[model samples]
Target: MPVISYELPDRFVAGAVGQPGERAFYLQARSGRRVTSVALEKFQVTLLAERLEELLDEVRRRGGDDAPVPAATPSELLDDEPLDQPVEEEFRVGTMALAWDPEGEQVVIEAQEATEGESAEPEVGDDDPAIAVLRVRITAAQARAFAERALKVVAAGRPPCPLCGNPLDTAGHVCPRQNGYLG
Candidate 1:
């Protein structure tokens, strides 16, 4: 299956169309006029942002950021609305990874489709093009912006319980740690 690769996206963001925990999480990359949306777990979005930040930090430590890549400001290329209405999940993500391409001088994020249930096979092979893989490339500056935006977006969800660390809806939640006690 051919991978949907976006090399140096002009606009990239991780966004949710609906309320947190009740909505889908997507990683969108747009180059020129081509736009691709890929489905992923909310935690994946959080981890992706964190890892991207780490990658950029490593580059800076190694003097790679000194290149003429031109630092990109998050606000300048940010897309609050990454996708069109009636958002759909391209595929349920199974495994994902991130790496810095020294030659390419970009952070590459790759996500593979997760197969249903458990598998006994020694190896996994996907022949479905529609659910093959999604890859996005972005710069160190863009990564920093993404990390900042993603942290904010994830935090904007339901506030967490101070004691139990569980997300509390507007109606609150019956935290098991409270043992039937609202307080």
Candidate 2:
């Protein structure tokens, strides 16, 4: 969700007579990026910005503009008062950091350097890799997609458990995945 540009075309005159001209613009959204062109008369351009503002206002009121991805939760976990903190899960590839969230189901995949003591700022670029965080209410199809992508990414590397930082070499373990009973 970046504001790539906000400018008027040079060909279109602000107060020109005759038929109204057309204008084009660019906007980049999260799901995908697109270049949109609008054909409007000179008078329409001024109104366009205001109209867009009003439309955005309405969208905000309806909670449709920039709506956050809802996190997933088990039915039993949806009590009035949550008993425990949100679980912290980490998927790793080699020594690079991927996505991270304190709470919520949205998985953000972006590359960030590991600072020895403090949280390092993410490096900005077109080629940076990302980690996807899944929500509790994510559907089976969505979950499968997330898992598949993560597998493809981590498959080329080994991941260490977040708790013990031990490499999960095989299926044998008494960790959290084993229910802690050590059967």
Candidate 3:
């Protein structure tokens, strides 16, 4: 397996490209000149952000006020920049793992490449050379920034219909609550 690991990367973020409904989401990590971008579904990005927040909150609660984790993303750490240029996808993420490193006081995020017909659970210690992983280690503040940005990116998509909660297209969409009428 090829692992692209960034330890305390200079930049790590979630961003998207293209218009509203047609957008593609990506997770990017850059350290010095080396950059790694991984493709993933919008839902994946949303879940990652939500989970990261929950994880950080739990850590803070357990560690009390002395924890390095912050209640919010520090203003200086808030990154609103777009994904790095080229936006080349190294791999499509299949499974993702997140953890809080107590010793390093960092959040570790690992996105594993998706494989066709792969087992639901990744085997421990299974070295599959075909699989590629993008691993990024970032401070709690950085993680919070990333999550906040990711949620914004996801929300930037097409607006949802009030009737059915389905995304509305530029020309409108058929809403289930409206009996398939364009709403």
Instruction: For model 1, state the Cα shift of residue 114 in Å.
Output: 1.1
- Candidates by TM-score, descending order: 3, 1, 2
TM-score of each: 0.80, 0.18, 0.94
Local error of candidate 2 at residue 128 (angstroms)? 20
Worst 10 residues of 1 by lDDT: 118-127
Per residue, candidate 2 scores C-alpha lDDT tens digits across 1-183 of: 221221221111112112212222111111122222222222233343333334334434555545332232234322222112221213211112123222443222232222344344433233323422111222222322333332332233335665654445456345575566332
On TM-score, the leading prediction is: 3
Candidate 1, clashing residue pairs?
none
Q: Which window of ten consecutive residues has the lowest lDDT sum in model 3?
A: 119-128
| Model 2 residue 79 CA deviation in Å | 36
lDDT (Cα, tens digit) per residue for candidate 3, span 95-155: 8888888999999888889988766765323446789988788999999999999999999
lDDT by residue for model 1 (126-167), tens: 335655677777776777777777777778787889989888
Residue 17 lDDT in candidate 3: 91
lDDT of the structure predicted as candidate 3: 0.89
Clashing pairs in 3: none
Measured on C-alpha atoms, candidate 1 has an lDDT of: 0.71
Candidate 1's displacement at residue 58, Å, is 2.0
